[model samples]
Target chain A: EDKVVQSPLSLVVHEGDTVTLNCSYEVTNFRSLLWYKQEKKAPTFLFMLTSSGIEKKSGRLSSILDKKELSSILNITATQTGDSAIYLCALFMEYGNKLVFGAGTILRVKS
Target chain B: NAGVTQTPKFRVLKTGQSMTLLCAQDMNHEYMYWYRQDPGMGLRLIHYSVGEGTTAKGEVPDGYNVSRLKKQNFLLGLESAAPSQTSVYFCASRRLRITNTGELFFGEGSRLTVL
Candidate 1:
């Protein structure tokens, strides 16, 4: 079965803290990995990583995939209260146009 | 542009009842998918359509049926709603051109509760 696991299901951190969320997956025909932030109703795209060791970044957020290890990490620098939300990692498989997602990491940044 | 829209944002149903959730995308995407979000399950793909008139089952597709008769719309139907079916349903669409990175645009989700 294709599976994805995320570490530290939930977390609480003070502002200015740097946080790292991890995701490991086991899926066939894995094409790329995507990170999303779910605040309320919908999850917004953050980054997409396709190559190993190649980091995808946007402002304070960044992610890199390690295909050799079958894992990926999302890093947030200088976390703020507004960063409190669920971070989701998903693998987009080559077939069926499907995306298998991990359980997600719920982060809470306190001011 | 309304990227992806799901109707009946919230609904409550009794066991044995039936419901259909509608998803429409105006991005002209060829790929549309249905997913259910549970407490610890993240998002499980229930069904997907690669194009108009083509539908396929996904990770967790057992009690759900889907239709993609139109290129811009996909419908997920629950034949017999059960407590196990209570979940937040999300619809996503993505444009796949060559070896794309798969950036999916999602809807605001439909919250369903089965009593």
Candidate 2:
């Protein structure tokens, strides 16, 4: 079975602080890693990391995949109250379209 | 574009009752999936379909069944509702041949409560 584990299940940070969420996985035939942000409804796509060492960024959020280490990290700099949400990481299998997701890290940013 | 849509945004069912959750995608995606989200655990796939007329069991397929009779519709059915089955269900779809990136577009989600 494929497994994905995330660190720091929950974290609380003040505004303007920087936070890093970690996700590590074990799977056969790795294809890509995806990050999502969930508030009240379904999760929204944040980034998709396919190549290792190459960083993908969107505004205050950025993510990088380390295939050799079998892990990925999502970084949020200059965080705001609007950044409070559950961050999810998922690993897609190579052959099939199956995605194994982590338990997710819940972030709370206070102003 | 209504990328993905789930019917009955909220539902309540008694123990032993049955219900079917409908999912539809207008993007003409070839892949459709059903997942359940719990409080601490992330979304777990209950079932999925790679294309029309084909369904596959996922990580946690027990107590749940799925059908993909059409190209754009996937239905998840609970034979007998249980309290443990109460959770938020999400439907997602994606194109397979276009990319290996695996970016799944999700629906608003359906909250199911079993009393």
Candidate 3:
């Protein structure tokens, strides 16, 4: 079974705090790892990691993939109230070009 | 520029009732997918289409059917609604040949309630 697992299903952080979210996948044809931030209605794209040891950064959010361990991590620095959202991790498979998703990490940032 | 659009932003149906949700993408992409988001389960794939006439089941497809008669439109049909089927349905589109950083674009989502 191809699946992805995210750690710390829910997390709480104070303003200016930094946190880390973890994702591990066991897929047959892993092509890329994608991160998305879902707020009220739709999920917004965050980052897509394909190469090991390479990091992708956007503002205060950064992510990196470790192909050897079949794991990935998302780091958020300077958390704010607006950063409270569900963070999703998914694996993109080469075959069928489909994505297998994790349950997601719920993040709550307090002011 | 309408990236991806889903019709009927919200709907309510009784058990055994049938309904259809429509999804359209103007980006001319080759892939479209239907997903359901529940409270604990993030997003589960219901069905997907690779092209205009090709459709396939995903992780969970027992209660749904889909068709892609046109390149820009994908329709999801619920032959018989069940209480467990109540969820927020999302429509997404992606390029056929994806790059390392290429990500999916999602619709605003349609909230469905089954009684």
Candidate 4:
């Protein structure tokens, strides 16, 4: 069965700290990996990583995918209280026809 | 722009009660999907439609029914509610030929509790 697993189901960090979240997947047809941030409402898209080695960045957040390892990592630098939320990792498989998600990593940034 | 909208943001029902969750998209996307989120379970696709008048099952599709009679609307129906069915339902949509990131636009979600 296709599966996506995220490590450290939950994390706590102080403001201005740096953190890394991990996601590993074992699936038949792996296409792309996506990250999302869910706060009080629905989830908002973060980054989509397709190629390995290359990193995608946005302000204080960045992510990279390693196809050889079948894993990905999301890094947050100079974290703030606003960064507190559930970071979700999803895999787009079956030619991008299906999206399978992991249990997600809950991040709490204390001020 | 009202990317995607779900009606009845919250609902509560007793066992065996029936109800339908509505999803609408204004982006004119050809692909739409319904998913449920639960504790320890990120998001599981219940049903999806590629276009108008078409539907397909996903990972967990049991006890759920879906219909896409029009291009802009998709509906999910639960014939008999169960406590196990209590979850937050989300609706999402994306274009047929995904461009750029191929990201999905999601609704605010509907919270359902089955007693």
Q: Give the best candidate by DockQ.
A: 1
Docking class of 1: high
Query: How well does candidate 3 score on lDDT at residue A3?
Result: 81
Error of model 4, residue B57, in angstroms: 0.5
Better of 2 and 3 by TM-score: 2
DockQ-better candidate, 3 vs 4: 4
TM-score for chain A as predicted in candidate 2? 0.96
Between prediction 1 and prediction 4, the one with superior DockQ is: 1
Residue lDDT tens for model 4, B8-61: 999999999999999999999999999999988899999999899999998889
Cα lDDT tens digits, model 4, A1-111, are 789999889999999999999999987466689999999878999999989999999999999999989899999999999999999999877563768889999999999
Worst 10 residues of 1 chain A by lDDT: A25-34
- Tens digit per residue, CA lDDT, model 1, A1-111: 788899989999999999999999876477889899999889999988888999988899989999889899999999999999999999888876788899999999999
Candidate 1 lDDT, B13-77, residue by residue in tens: 99999999999999999999999999878999999998999999898899899999999999999
Residue ranges of candidate 4 with Cα displaced over 4 Å: B98-101
Better of 1 and 3 by lDDT: 1
Cα lDDT of model 3 by residue, B1-115, tens digit: 9999999899999999999999999999889999999887889999999899999999999999999999999999999999999999999998776354448899999999999
Given candidate 4, what's the lDDT at residue B53?
97
lDDT of 4 at A106: 95
Report the Cα lDDT for candidate 4. Answer: 0.92
Q: Which of the predicted structures, 1 or 3, would earn the higher DockQ when compared with the native? A: 1
For model 2, how does the per-residue alpha-carbon lDDT over B45-91 read when each residue is reduced to its tens digit? 99999999999999889999999999899999999999999999999
Please, what are the lDDT tens digits per residue for candidate 3 over residues A6-62?
989999989999999999988747778999999997899999998899999999999
